[model samples]
Target chain A: MIGRLNHVAIAVPDLGAAAERYRSAFGATVTGPDALPEHGVTVMFIELPNTKIELLAPLGADSPIAAFLARNPAGGMHHVCYEVDDILAARDRLLATGARVLGTGEPKTGAHGRPVLFLHPKDFDGTLIELEEVA
Target chain B: MIGRLNHVAIAVPDLGAAAERYRSAFGATVTGPDALPEHGVTVMFIELPNTKIELLAPLGADSPIAAFLARNPAGGMHHVCYEVDDILAARDRLLATGARVLGTGEPKTGAHGRPVLFLHPKDFDGTLIELEEVA
Candidate 1:
């Protein structure tokens, strides 16, 4: 059901600063620091060899990332994302195994125009996991 | 200073059950699932492309993973790990950038024959991050 690790999401207070830190420390370059209006967060992705490190900062109070940051004031790790070959098949399997899907609707295009879906933290044992099918 | 993603650490209450669930859902095989006496927990790894999903369950009260599980009972997501080429250098640079290193000691071999080091959640803003230099 899962392919590679698409990306690892980190919630930051400032995206530009985090991206600069990553670049200076690891020689990683930001791929896309695009603003996800629907998700209400601005995401900056630093491309690594096998996986990308995502820097997420909440745009406002209504954004999920902001809510997460509020809950974790120190702003530690955020979420784990897995690359799935078939989003629908993976979702169905997760559901069959009693995992709760965050969205009852279809998977949508995410930060990089990839088809993405989320499994609620409740079903996955408090982890907000994302399943993305990279095009 | 990194290799491929060694594994993702997820804090769970029941290692056995979660492992079973993963096998059932993704046809994945657990690699280690071994207990790290020093870390005070048992870890089960589900291998996938470019990364491994780690299921971390506490063996006793003193385990860090157990503490994490306690804080987040619903058991959502845990931490993100990056494959680093040199654990020592990575640690040094991160410290230089005002990032806190969890251990002031040398990198040690983990569940597998991999050298692993952890960055403090304080430095990364509430995220417990790990760096592994895989052999």
Candidate 2:
């Protein structure tokens, strides 16, 4: 159902500092500070040879990352994304197995401009799993 | 520097059920209920095409997973492991940047029989990071 590991998303109180850490410490290529109003996050991508790291900061008061930061003031690992060949098919298959998909059960444009959906953390042994459709 | 995502570790109260979920739901190849007494955890790996998912359960009363399960009852994402070319060099680089490596700042033999070290969650924006020296 899941393909390659797309990226790991981290919620950070200070996105710039987190990006700098990856840049200076690992010499990673950092890109974007793009505001994703629909997702309520301002994101940056730290690219690596195999996978990418996403740094997310709250974009508004109701941002999910803001709530996460409130619980863990320093920010933390928010989610892990995996690529799927067909997200809708994956969703349907998962749903058939009693998995809960987050949001309106519809795929939305993700940071990579690909369709993505989040699965309920409780259903995935407490890990928030994101499924992104591979283009 | 990180090479690839080695695995995403999830702390589960019941490793068998979690492993079964992946096996039955996604038809993933699942292996191990191996007990790592040194780490105080019993672990299983759900092998995906690209990356693996590690399901962790407490091996003893002193197990870290026991503590995590105490707080989260339902289990959750514990840590993310990334591969590195050189363990010592990565350690020195991370330390020079004031990153706190967990435990004794030395690599321990991990599940994959590789030298691995954990970074402090607090220092890493609340994300527990594991760096494994790939063979």
Candidate 3:
């Protein structure tokens, strides 16, 4: 089951500008510009008291965010991540109830170095949901 | 500035079916089918350990969610709300930084009966940001 709201990811055309806005306007601590080739994103985290905001930019033309940006040139909310106690258990439970997990239907190492899986947007209405196992 | 994440709102085509999915699949405590005619939406809250998920559906043909659903029939994430210590102060600061606040730049009573202001999605890289003054 879903635990804490880990972080809400936003796809941005300019990661640095987005990070700067959080830094200067909101005074949030901006961390990372970590290039995650596996996820095909360059990400930055805006630290908050209770949760974090992830700013993502496409790493390549083939990146998923790239397609999102192509449609929404201004970029937008990409996904919402929820922490789980056990990734496999959560996946199984969701699958048993007919929820479709994205990707290879297995957990993969996420940006946080924890196991994560994405749920199909179609299954959850229209919002893409991500489940990350707490490390 | 933003405080805690108040909730992530998802616009669903079928409010009851969406609430049922959360209750039966994730065992989330679902509350409300509260109709806010001002916002032209009916909403439900899916309680979580650290945050809540708001499920929204169009209350009328004029509802904004109806437009979103017309484009995305499956439903999807609508907006993210963040709590602010002082709504007025937050609004001034954001405006000073060239961020355009939506709807005549005035705070309206949101679902929680708290003063809330919305920031333009274009200004924030396409993610509609809501700042709610915690009561």
Query: Of the candidates shown, which would achieve the greatest TM-score relative to the real structure?
Result: 3
**DockQ of candidates 1 onward, in order?**
0.60, 0.66, 0.73
Question: How high is the TM-score of chain A in each model?
Answer: 0.86, 0.92, 0.94
Which candidate tops lDDT?
3
Candidate 1 wrongly placed segments (more than 4 Å)? none
DockQ score, prediction 3: 0.73
* lDDT per residue as tens, model 1, B1-135: 545656677888888877787777666777666888777888888888676788888876688666666777756557767787777888787777777767555787765668878777666656667788854
Q: Kindly give the stretch of ten consecutive residues in candidate 2 chain B with the minimal lDDT sum.
A: B20-29
**What is each predicted model's overall lDDT from 0 to 1?**
0.75, 0.85, 0.87
What DockQ does predicted model 1 obtain? 0.60
Q: List the residue pairs that clash in candidate 3.
A: A126-B75
DockQ, 0 to 1 scale, candidate 2: 0.66
TM-score on alpha carbons, each prediction: 0.88, 0.93, 0.95
Question: lDDT for model 1, on a 0 to 1 scale?
Answer: 0.75
Expressed as tens digits, the lDDT of each residue in B1-135 for candidate 3 is 668888999999998999888777676789999999888999999888888889999987699778888888899888999899899998899888988999889899987889999998888888888899985
Write one digit per residue (lDDT tens) for candidate 2, span B26-132. Answer: 66789998989988999999877778888999886688677778998998888988889999999999999888998899999988788999998877788898999
For each of the candidates, what fraction of the native contacts does it recover?
0.64, 0.64, 0.70
Candidate 1's chain A scores what TM-score? 0.86
Write one digit per residue (lDDT tens) for candidate 3, span A33-117.
Answer: 9998887999999877788889999996578788889998999988999898999988888988899999899898888899999
Candidate 2 stretches greater than 4 Å from native: none
Q: C-alpha displacement of B127 in model 2, angstroms?
A: 0.9
